[model samples]
Target: MKKLFTTDFKQRCINLMLHEQHTVAETSKIMNVSISALQRWKVQYIKEKQGITPVKPAITAEQREIQRLRTEVEQLRSDNALLKKVSAFFLDKH
Candidate 1:
């Protein structure tokens, strides 16, 4: 059976993947959708914005490595922020 979704809902999903930096697979899983469905939605969303449909690009190993590094950097930044907050709290106590 084919399910009908609103344009607003599709835009929100695309926003999650684009603006929020969520991976397509992550957004798909979170939204209870298939990755391919999300990909198609993304393409439609782009076309709506730019008036042109972009070709799907293949994922390369270097792209994967860059994504992995970006994730790691975000994690490290979060850990550093937590450590700073803890340090400030202890220093205030002393």
Candidate 2:
């Protein structure tokens, strides 16, 4: 059976490798996980750190605020565009 790791466990493994400056092979051996899994976790870790992916529940307050603001801005922009279209339609009908 394949072992399933929790997000916390995956993050801990990635952090151990990164913060302790351990190579992927070393980390894999120490963590008892596959080297390929470690490599993939490292890539995912970097992407999450760079905000390229939606972070898990461990996201900081600042990141949460930024995400909320971004969502609000997108919604506002969509609403503005819709209003503009409606205005244009009304004006054309007059």
Candidate 3:
């Protein structure tokens, strides 16, 4: 997955957390995300708004592709492992 810069993620997260009155865990769950992930985003937002350098905005397609590819790669790895085991069984003598 692409690493989000500190500021932008934080700002969006704050928007969600504050205006929505979302709990750390609840917000994360509704978004299908982890609490620590949102927490980190919150930190980055605060740090940047406090005077740190700005983070670039994320593209939806790019983020979607990142998640998709990560899942695909994992599945491919698992399939390859199974194939390797099957091949080994076929090649080995009893």
Candidate 4:
């Protein structure tokens, strides 16, 4: 039968490997889990603590939109400035 660990238990396992300085192998053995599972949990915990969650996918979409808007705005500004310059040059000539 497979064992299902709770959130608290999963955090505890990660803490043992991190704060307690236990190796992944040791934590897996002590927690009765696979080493791969412990390693995966540790990676997720570290990423979460570093503010790099899977939620970044949403931020990525926002960032892409912001970049696109910025590019469009810059192009518009450049076109407007060029038109103004042309208008001023024609006014001076006339």
The number of the candidate with the highest TM-score is 2
- In model 2, the runs with Cα more than 4 Å from the true position are 54-94
TM-score for candidate 1, residues paired by index: 0.52
Stretches off by above 4 angstroms in model 3 are 1-12, 54-94
Report the Cα lDDT for candidate 4: 0.73
Task: Report backbone clashes per prediction.
Answer: 0, 0, 0, 0
Candidate that scores best on lDDT? 2
Tens digit per residue, CA lDDT, model 2, 5-84: 87667777887888888888888888899988888778766766776645443233444566678889999999999999
- Sorting all predicted structures by lDDT, with the top scorer first, yields 2, 4, 1, 3
Cα shift from native, residue 55, model 1 (Å): 16
Candidates in order, TM-scores: namely: 0.52, 0.55, 0.44, 0.53
Of the candidates numbered 1 and 3, which has the greater TM-score value?
A: 1
Backbone clash pairs for candidate 4 read: none
lDDT of each: 0.73, 0.76, 0.64, 0.73
RMSD of each: 13.5, 5.0, 11.6, 11.2
Higher-ranked by TM-score: 3 or 4: 4
Kindly list the per-residue Cα lDDT of model 1 for residues 1-94, writing each as its tens digit.
9877765677678889999999999998888888888898777556545544234321333433555666799999999999999999999999
Candidate 3 lands at a TM-score of: 0.44
TM-score, prediction 4? 0.53
**Cα shift from native, residue 28, model 2 (Å):** 0.7
Candidate 4: regions farther than 4 A off: 55-94
